[model samples]
Target: MGIISMIIIGLIAGAIARLLVPGKENFGWIGTILLGIVGGYVGGTLGSMVFAPHKFTVQPPVNHAFLGAIVGAVILLVIYKFVRARV
Candidate 1:
C-alpha cells in the first residue's frame, strides 16, 4: 500500500480501536495515526506468523490488516495504560 493509503487505513483503524477500547487516551489525531500505523505493522507481522507461518509475506490482505490493526492497537493501548499506571 502507498503512504496515503496506509495513513487512511491507519486513521480508520485507530479510530475504531479507540472506540472499542474504553478509556481516556490523551493523544490526539497524529498520535492516533501513529498508533494505527504501528499497530498495522505489529498486527500484520503477528497475523502472518499465526495464519501463514510458512508463507510469510510483507503485506497481509486489507481485511486481515484492518482487523489486525484494531487488535494490535488495543493491545498497545492496554500496555500503555499499564506502563502509565506504574510510572
Candidate 2:
C-alpha cells in the first residue's frame, strides 16, 4: 500500500519474472522496478476483469497479486522482445 512496500513488491516480482522467462533482459534495477510496477497494474486490471467483473472495489489478496504481477511481467517481457526484434 505504501510507496516502499510497492517498490519492494515490484523488485521481487520483477526479479522472479525475469527468472521465469528464458531470455536475457538488459534492464537494470530501476527498469526492473518500473517493469514490476507496470506489470502490477496490468495484472491487477486483468485479474479484476477475470475474477470479479461486477465489483469495482474488490481486490485480490497480496499473494495473488504478487503471482499475477509475475505473470504480467513475463508477458510484458515477451512482448518487448518481440517488438524489439521487429524494430
Candidate with top TM-score is: 2
User: Clashes in model 2: which pairs?
Assistant: none
Q: TM-scores, in order shown?
A: 0.85, 0.85
| Per-residue accuracy of model 2 over 21-56 as CA lDDT, tens digit each | 888988999999988888898888888888864553
Off by over 4 Å in 2: 53-62
Model 1 Cα shift for residue 46 (angstroms): 0.8
Question: What are the candidates' C-alpha RMSDs?
Answer: 3.9, 3.4
- Estimate candidate 1's alpha-carbon lDDT, on a 0 to 1 scale: 0.85
Candidate 2: TM-score? 0.85
